[model samples]
Target: MLLVLSDEHKEHLAFLPEVDSAVVGEFGRIAVEFLRKGSTPKIYEGAARKLNVSADTVQHGVEGLMYLLSESSKLMISEVDFQDSVLVLGFPEDLNRLLLQLYLDHRKEIRQILSELAPSLPHYHNLEWRLDVMLASRALRHQVKPTVSLKLHLESGGDHIARVLQTDPATLLHLIQELERALAEAKTNHCRRILRNIK
Candidate 1:
């Protein structure tokens, strides 16, 4: 997402010890005011009148803000158009892609799973499945080996129909894949049973 900061917001950042507050405050009021209005046109005279500071002071303070923002890792000023006078600041494309993947894994994964399951749900009543996919705790005991467990609840009452545990990470993946194939077979058999009863 593009980074948009208000003139008042920039002024608040002036509190950082490295920036001179007097200069930041004046420049934020005058020069940043023009930038906030959606253009970066030179406004030395207008800023000077608003802040009661010399045009040179406003210019110097704004330069300081630009320098500080340039050094920031969180945001980058991609373009500074001297001709039309505009500033475009945003996250770099690589960083944006990384953030998007993280968002998909953490926030959108469950919704995606549900969407994938939707088409198969209407064939029978009370057809629900719960998958408790969890990681092992970090704390270790002397003889206890680290293991991953998957508990599958194939019915509505929440009774776990199948529980699989494997100590090796590579083996655990294979176990889960086999269990998923078995689950698909079980679901198909269940649908056949429903159709037989109807006939």
Candidate 2:
């Protein structure tokens, strides 16, 4: 998979060329540390002082590297693909190689950290629904009203949460149609390609 870098991220990483290769290595380390532990202002300040650059520049550089590494790791791109992704940044050959090496060395650890940090959200377990029809009410001798009741069961961390919803039959039908449309759209080639790159 080829990772696409946004303009803002490209700009953030622009300062890397001016910095020393050793410093760039340090930035990679800082990026990993930032992922493992949250941001540390003091580390940024020290790096800034050592590099003789503003803390914001150092921060942006580290963040840009973090974004690059995390996205590449998230997609689990191969070494050659990662090198190609960084090549588009217009960095020198050595720098590109260095970035690829950094990613290769730390991809596993970064993936682990990311997995641990991911939010544990509820997922669909089961669904139950009922349809009720009212006919021949006292006020309207020939009236008919249809209602749909839905019970959605979601499982989160081994616990089940049930949500009850009630809606008119027409609205429920519309909702189902919309959901089906969305599912169909998700199956399209464009969406499948995008989803593949995202993974």
Candidate 3:
């Protein structure tokens, strides 16, 4: 199913120009736009509106798009079935891999995200936003079931410690805090012991 297009999705679709593959290109663009939006359009109506092509032309284009998607759909460990003459999918658990591939289809940002940030801040420059993949994965894990969400609890000091340790932010923050607390408690104990001896 294709949903309405967002500005970002449209901008993404607009780049699919092919010298000798206009229909394939447009089909790719429209199909991807549908994927990002999470809905499949009524092919003739939607493609006609967008491309100013005849409904029959758009139908031919969509057949190509559906063929490509159906082909990839076969490669996945997941399965789709037809019930009441409608197509459906099984194994939703692994769909993340598909989405991740599509998400990386925009690699222009990866240069800024993975390469540039890995040097300057080494963790995330201003915040953990540097590892959006990490963030997104954390969010996904929590969404899978009920447990203490590392992403949520580490929201504060975790990001700072990740910057300093350049490793797992949450673990480093805990160690840092434990060391600080030990120092503070040690000072207090020393003072209390000295006062007791003098008394």
Candidate 4:
């Protein structure tokens, strides 16, 4: 059964075992607020002051929250920095299909962009493309999703340009179109060569 917590319930998530109720509530509150602002929350003294809890209590709350989130196999959390005390929590890779459709819709433009951009690097020769998809959640089974990334590597170069994520798809499409016309011309020349040698 999916547990849908209203904002109020999220604020009062007191079921976390072995931690003070106040600490659990404060941590949940902070997490919801950070999610609202679309960024990760850093646990520190300032956050403790805002939550009206001690820095140590805030630290405990952060740990409790991590534990609670970690219990679910579908959810994953990665500690980005121990010194900075920042944690990123989100869905598992297989179920994270938010940008799948966007990339698939723009696949042609994406390929054109990579083919154009990689050759500009020094000592460039040829390029390769790989596309993969994450299986959708049961609710979104009807939708087609592609991984929201492009991996580019030059034949003669080391790891220069590794991966490119989403950035202004519309603008990238325009730029991709510019060089694709040249690629089309190249294909035509190849066709001419084959025709001349056929007989």
Candidate 5:
């Protein structure tokens, strides 16, 4: 998957070229630490003093690195794909290699941190559905109308929520078909690539 950096991120990371490779490595470490322990203004200030740059510039540079690593890890792109993704930044060969090495070294740990940070949401537990057919009515004799009733159960954080829904058979069938179509689309290569880049 190709990770496309936004123009703003590109501008923010532009300061990296002037910095030393060891400083870039330090920025990578700081980025990961920021993810795990939140931001530290004092450290940024100290780095800014050492690099003779503004604290805001140092902060933005670290943040840009964080965004790069996190997005690459979230997509789990292969090494070649990762190298290709960073190539757009127009960094020198050694800088690109350093960034790639940083990504490779911390991808797993970054993913773990991201997963922990993600919000917990309700998920499917069970579904119960019933079909009700009316064979006759006072207005319409010898007529059939089918309705579908559903009980959708969801579980979140050890708590269960149940929802009741009712719809005509035609509408229910349409919804089912639409959902199936969506599932099929999600499995396509084009859709996968779009989704990967979306992250």
Candidate 6:
């Protein structure tokens, strides 16, 4: 059952995680005002140094609150990846296919969040473009829904992508130190062949 939060609910949600207790207090206050005044409540992200919190801590805490609200709304849920950096929730089973908004609308923050979930990083602009076009096309130009697709789709002219795929950029430059050892082996191989020819 969806229970509508009121100004009276502020003191209750205060008991949530203390990632930014004071900022949460402010959110409660704004939530109450908006509940009573019918105004849009402002979202607050607290400072890192002031809270002695890393950005991932802040991002994860915010995502926690978002999931809480999603649970309240009874949204279908699934984790998008290993780091749990991206979450996508929707109800395709309903046929009407309701997709509730479970997001913070910042592109840069999404990019930064993805950068921490290492092994690799991906382009955030491409991510945004995919989603925007999905929303724009859904049940309008097309009835097909977006399922998470990660592998780069290949085209005929993909030489640059092929080269980059050969080595991860983060490790590419770091592998240079190993080249000298390979060169030493090659030099020894050449000297051994020359000695055989002279003999």
Best by lDDT, which number?
Answer: 5
Off by over 4 Å in 1: 1-41, 74-199
Q: Give each model a TM-score.
A: 0.21, 0.79, 0.23, 0.21, 0.74, 0.21
Compared with the true structure, what per-residue lDDT tens digits does model 2 show for residues 65-144? 99999989988989989988888889998898889889999999999999999999999999999988875568876657
Clashes of each: 0, 0, 5, 1, 0, 0
lDDT of 2: 0.91
Error of 3 at 15 (Å): 21
Root-mean-square deviation of each candidate, in angstroms?
A: 22.0, 3.0, 22.9, 24.9, 3.9, 25.1
Runs in model 6 with CA error above 4 Å?
Answer: 1-16, 19-21, 26-46, 75-199
Worst 10 residues of 3 by lDDT: 82-91
Q: What tens digits encode model 6's per-residue C-alpha lDDT throughout 1-199?
A: 2223343333333233443445644433443333334433123234445567564444444434433433332322232221132212221332111112222222233334334433542322221112212456444864544433233433333322211124343354466657877667757968779765543
Best candidate (score: TM-score): 2
Q: Tens digit of lDDT per residue, candidate 5, span 53-110? A: 8999999999999999999999898999999988999999999999999999999999
Q: State the lDDT of candidate 1 residue by residue for 1-199, as single tens digits.
A: 2345566544533332333444444543443343334335357567667667666655555553443333221232233221111122243444334323322232233234334444542122233333344455567443444454444334334333443433555676787899999878867978779766543
Clash pairs detected, candidate 4: 100-146
Alpha carbon lDDT of each predicted model: 0.43, 0.91, 0.41, 0.43, 0.94, 0.37
Model 2 — TM-score against the truth?
0.79
Residue 12's C-alpha lDDT in candidate 6? 34
| Residue-by-residue lDDT tens digits, candidate 3, 29-50 | 5555554444444765875787
- At residue 99, candidate 3 shows an lDDT of 33
